[model samples]
Every structure is written in structure tokens, then in C-alpha cells.
Target: MTGTIHNRETFLSQIASSLGRSRLSSGVTDPEWKHRPQDQVLQDATPDELVDILKTQCLKIHTSLVITDAKKLPETLHEVVANYGGGPIVTWKDERFSKWGLEPLMKKEWPSQKLEVYEWDHTKGAENIRQAEKANVGITISEMTLAESGTVVLFSDKDKGRTVSFLPATYIALVPKSTIVPRITQAARKLRELHHSGKQVASCVNFITGPSNSADIELNLVVGVHGPVKATYIVIDDL
Candidate 1:
């Protein structure tokens, strides 16, 4: 009976592989991704200029922010955040934000501010969600940043709650220059590589291009319907 069961499982596995429905047997690696153009990647692109761009492209600055570039998250964040009103709470995604060594930085920069960082454990409950909804600003790292459209991609998982990025009135992104892809096609290629690596794609992979703005009411422009009203991207140099 055991042998029969094992054989049946193997047969089904083979069929799934043939149909390209099997899980990733290989880890995170893809040569095709390496060939993507460097020009397409987003970067610092003038922090001062970004301020103006956000004004024209964005609808409201209610949730205004100062995002740090990915590589120079240390350098840019400390300086930029100093000017904004002291935020009540600071949020982060679990893996990348944790690995990037933000705890020490947060302590140093937001010493007096209430600092709250959560891991994507799914069971962490919904406190982060509720806080984010009322937060003056929300900060997180992006999987990819699009320079062309000035967008950031948030891949929410167990640690990085989706609400931390969306529910907040203001959204700030820390994007690494290297992760800035020129087009959606390049992003798709990278996504395929990530999927093939057996990693769990977050239930919500949100693509945020500036703040939420719509001109649906007969030429009247409105912002913050489905997401944030204010958005800012901090494109950091490679660390």
C-alpha cells in the first residue's frame, strides 16, 4: 500500500511538472534577470527634484514623507526625516527592513518617537493595521521601483503587513537604485524568478505609482480613494 501511494504521488508530480504547475525546485537565480538594462533601474534622481515631482504628480501631501534610498538608506533617511514633523510611529517590513539594519537607525533617528516594527508572522494580529490607518506616515522597503512612472512595488507577506503601506495617509518608500526597473516587462521577469525560487509571494503585491488620484467625477480630481493621499519614493544609491 505504501509503495502504491508513493508511485501515485510520483506520477502526479510528473504530470504537474509537465503542465508547469509544480513548485519551484530551484532556488532564487535566473540569468535572464541579470541581462536587464541598468538604465531602466531607478535611482536618487535628485532628491530635491523628487520633492517637486511629487507635488505635480501627487494629489495631496497629507501623508507627506521623506523616503531613504535603498543603498544609502542610512545616509538619506537620517537627513531627510529630520525636516518633516516628528512622526508618531515608524513601520517596516520584516525581512528586508530588518536585514537592512533599520532598528539601530530608527533608534538613532526617531529616539523620542514611538517606534513600532512588526515581523510578517500573519499571527501578529491587526494592531499594526489599525495604527497604520491613523498614522501620519508609513514607511517600508520596496521590492522594485519604477523610475518611468515613479512607482514602488510593495510585496506584503507575513511580516510586512499590506496595511502598513496602503492604509496610511502618507506613504514613503525606500527603493534601491538597482531594483529600479525601466518597464513592467522587466518587473515581470524578476517576478517570475522570484516565483520560481519557491518563495511565498505575498497575498497582495501592490504597485503604487505616486499617490492615489482619480479624475472620475467629471474632471474633478480626487485623491486617496483606495490608498494613500500622499506618496514619496526615496531612491538610494547601491550600498
Candidate 2:
């Protein structure tokens, strides 16, 4: 047991060091990969044009879902769901949806709406994705969201599996305002870091901006032809 422990620690340290060095060489070491400024920390939606964008996008999508930090579950999630037709709220084990005083609130807003609150364990990524796909909507917390391209980044590990975010019909991602970066290149650097750290690479890493759409044939646009038909994102001000 002692030898095994020593070997594992040694391996992890070596991997972390190599990953750090490689990322630095790849020009990923820069904190700001893009010149665009980080998105503003939005507290109230009324003033920000994002409100109109959110409303329009939500109405256009088939399913609207929101994934917020367990510590910062937005007060508006239930309201939005109720207005757009209620759907399930899939979360991770640490999300603490029940403890955050959300269950009762949702119950009140959507007395007749069915709420499927699932706790994700990373080992069950395959199962979780299957369940998320069956539902019309799915929401999961994100590591970070890029504002310029409207892309969301997800990392896989023991707690955050990949399926919950990628397989649903409409994916609602909750990202902290602080976690909002300017570009996908910054996100790719983070992924490279994770890869070098010897963490198990996710079977899937999705960077979703809008609804799953395709203009593959005749330049005619189509939605839900491949992935989720819709995606709604809420960048909570607080982490």
C-alpha cells in the first residue's frame, strides 16, 4: 500500500509539471488569450440587453434550462421555468438544490409541472447522459462560459460528468459572472491542463453556443437535427 501510494503521487506530480510546461510552450500560459474584455457582471437583467436576448432565445427554444452554481442558484430560475413551461432541474451531488430552498419554490411556481431533480455522480456519466437525453430540458453548472462566442466549457471528473450537459434537448448552463471569459482559446488551454494532470479525459467535451442546428443541406437551416434543439444560459453575478 505504501509503495502504491508513493508511485501514484510521483506520477501525478510528474504529469502536472509536464502539463504546465507544455501549455506554456503552446502559448496557452497567457491569462488573456483574446483581447476582448470580460463580460460585465450582471446583477439585474432589466437594464442589460441580455434580458431581451435571453427572453427571445428562451421563447425560440424547445426547452429552457438553467444550471447555476450550488452556492448561487439564481432566484429567477423558477420564474423563468414557469413562464416558459416548467421542466426538470438536473444537478450534481454538491448542487444542494433541496438545501438551497429551491424545491418548495419550484413546487409553488409549478404546482402541476413535473420537476426531475437528479444528482450526478461522475462514475455514471453514460447513464446520466441517457437520462438527460430522454428529457426535453437539462441544466448543469459549467466551469466557465466564453462571452464572445457564447460557448460553455465543461470538465469531466468524479462529480461533473459530460452527459448531463450535452445530451439534452435544451441545455441551460449556469456560469458565474466571474467565470465568463472572452474566448474559446482560453478554455482549450484549461482542457489541456486537465489532460496533462492525468485526470480521466471526458468521453465528450461540448462547447455549445445556441440550439443544435444544421444548415448542412441546401443552406436551409434546421434545428434539433443533431444535438439539443435549444440552449439557454444564465450567467449569475456571484460565484
Candidate 3:
């Protein structure tokens, strides 16, 4: 959904007036920086190199990474679900699942395997959250994958509920190789491009890196404090 800041101009004007200055909407120039080290990091890396970087980062974040081609995606996904304890699964109502050849797994194979599955329905509203809470695993297709940070980016909308990734005990992200970027810098650039092109940006954009863990309680690492206990990313090599 498109969001607007109410009374934004008035609010800024009030602040400017209090400071005895007029709002400077023009004649402002961006400052030059001495160094742009961010641009240099992994600047010339190839797709294969990026994948290697992502795999390394995944290990540090305690996230499992599985790389497979399009032909083996179904089998890889099935193996991941089964390894995570054969879920009462919840997934986003994303068309990519079908486009990527998961229609059979979601519709026929999973049911025949006696796995319970639920898709996020916008019409159901809060019922979706309840289902997500009950699920052992929640699955989603990542809109963008950050190789440097091993982050899976999700754009939440009518079909993609925020709870699909937040509430489930285990979280699984289907990462398309084509969507992998160098880092958040590239991700932010893409978002800016979308906005400049007048596309509707998602209200909630999640940058999830592995499972939730906090060291708040006596400085000991505690997992699953606010979200999933385990996380995995199955990267499709030929999606």
C-alpha cells in the first residue's frame, strides 16, 4: 500500500519557523565524501562468487543454506520440510510457488504425504495469524536476497502476511538466484528505483537473517525470543 505522511509540509514548516529559517527545498547540495568503501566491497564479484559469499555469511548467522537447480527444487524443498519435522506448514499466497514448479507439492504431493498446509488469505484476516502460530514451518519466496548479509527480503502485501515469517517455529525462504544482490546498498537502490518509477512499495519490508536470537537475558544467547527458532534458505540456482 502507498503511505502518505499527514501534515508533513506543515510539520516541517513549524520546525523551520521555530528555528527562524525558511524551508530549504531547493539550492541544497549533497556533500562529497572522502571515501565510498561500501561501493568497493564485492564490486566486481560474479554471481557464483556472490553465492559463495552468501553461503559463508549463512554459516555465521546460524542459517542453513541449500543450493539446487530448478529441476531438483521440488525434491530439495520436500527434504527441507521433512527435515524440519514434517510440518503443519503455512506459506504466502504467492504465485511464484506455482511458477517455480511447486504447485504439485503444495496441492497434491503434500496432501498425499499427510502434511497439513495453509496459505495466507487476505480475506481471512486474523485467522491467518492463528494458522501461522499453529504451523511448524512457514515458507515464502524472497523478493531480494542479500548475499553479503545472507538476508532474505520479503515484501508483505495482501497475499503475503507478515506473520508467515514471524509466528512460525521454523522459517524457510525460497531464494531465487536472479534476485541475489551484493548487499543492502543494492537492495535500497532497487527500492528507490521502484519509488521513482511510481510503483507501489510494500508497507512492510522484512530483512530477515536467520532465526531470531537475543543476548538480553544475562548476556547469554537465547534463540526464538521473538520469532522462529530455526531458519533456512533454499537458493534456486536456475529459477
Candidate 4:
């Protein structure tokens, strides 16, 4: 079920032959660009400075941002869930929840509060999507956060359903301070490095900025046309 390209070598060979050039798969280095402005953008910003940039960008993207330490994360999450109208919640089956001290809230607090919670189950298949569609809130941890664009990078694997972010009424992203990168340039470089190191990257990588926004209808900006109407990012300061 993996998205591995079986005919990649043959396909590239055919293209190379058509172009009258040998397949240059080995000993080929990346070209150097003199005017690489993308690398320069926010390049010198510290993590704290990046957070500040992200905060400002969030304001532009219509997303709420909250800063809290690991110790306060559970409480902060609870408050956010309450504000978004306690769920029918859907979340990724990620271990970071326990690592960041949210196991209690996930196992006890939410259930005791009579909130219906569903974690993404790969085995359940369509059932997960059904739950996500009915969910009032969907929660996920950001693999990476882009400061300049206020974007959250989601590398979707089996346990992380894309529908969890797309179908819910509200979305909450848990962003670790360490994941706060200056921009997409750094994120792209990280992905490239992973590929070069022969690591298995996720089949789907989603770069989400705030909620679903579109200006297709009458050229007027519309929010939540195809996804969550409200989005919040909880930035963990000491995770």
C-alpha cells in the first residue's frame, strides 16, 4: 500500500533517451544559485524570534495562537477544547500526546467530562472518516511549523488521517517550539535531507495555512469553504 514508484528507473531512462542525454543519477550535485533570497529570509532569526514571526503571521491567517510550557499544555488544551465547544473530538494516534503529558487529559479528563473522543485508527478505515466528519474538533501535532507563513506541516501516515484536519468544524495543532522553522525553505531542505538519507517519507505532505479560505465565489474571501472554520495553534514553549 506504499506509494513507492516501481517504474521510476525505466521512466527516467526513457525520458533521458528521448532527450539524447545519459541518465545522470550519480555524481550529479545540486546547482548553486547566486541569488538565493529564499535562504536569506528570516535565516538569522532565533527560535524565539521565529515564534514571534509566527504569532504575527497567525494574526493575518485568522488563526489563534497560544503559548504554553509542557507542564501547562494539558490545561491549555482543555481550555481550547472548551472554547471550541467540547467535542465529539478526533485526534491522530500520536505518541507525543503522552510524551508531552497529555495522557491524563486524553484518557481521563475528556471522558469524565462526557466528551466523545475518537483517535484515528488505520484499521478502522472509513469509520475514522465518519467520526472525523461528525467531530467538532480535530487535534494533531505539527511535524513542522513555518513562521513566515503561519503554516503547519503534516506528514500523513497511516495513523494520521487527512480527514481529521479537513472534515472537522474546528482544528487544533500542537506545535513544539523546536519545530518552529523560519519558512518553507528550511522545511523543504529537511525533506530533501530525509530523502537523501534513504529514509521513508510520508506519501502525503500537507502544508496547511490557517483554515480553508477561498475567493472563488464572487471574488469575495470566504473562510471554511472546504475545511475547518476555526483553527488554533498551541505552541509548546518547553516541549
Best by lDDT: 4
Order candidates by TM-score, high to low. Answer: 3, 4, 1, 2
Task: Name the lDDT of candidate 1.
Answer: 0.62
Give the worst 10-residue stretch by lDDT in candidate 4: 104-113
**Of candidates 3 and 1, the better by TM-score:** 3
**Ranking by lDDT, best first?**
4, 3, 1, 2
lDDT of 1 by residue, 67-130 (tens): 4545556556544444444354447645566466566554534455453433333565776666
Better of 3 and 4 by TM-score: 3
Candidate 4, residues 1-239, lDDT tens digits: the string is 65777998999999999999999967878798889999889889999999999999999999999999998898899999999989989999999999988886567465347778888889998999999999999999899899999999999999999898989999999999999999999999999999999998998999999999999879999988999999999999963
What tens-digit string does per-residue lDDT give for candidate 3 at 114-205? 78889889999889989999999999999999999999999999999999998999999999899999999889989999999999899899
Clashes of each: 8, 1, 0, 0
Worst 10 residues of 2 by lDDT: 39-48
Residue pairs with backbone overlap in model 3: none
Top candidate when judged by TM-score against the true structure: 3
**TM-score: the better of candidates 2 and 4:** 4
> What ranges in model 4 sit over 4 Å off?
1-29
* Position 47, candidate 1: lDDT: 42
Clashes of 1: 8
What is residue 154's positional error in candidate 3, in angstroms?
0.5
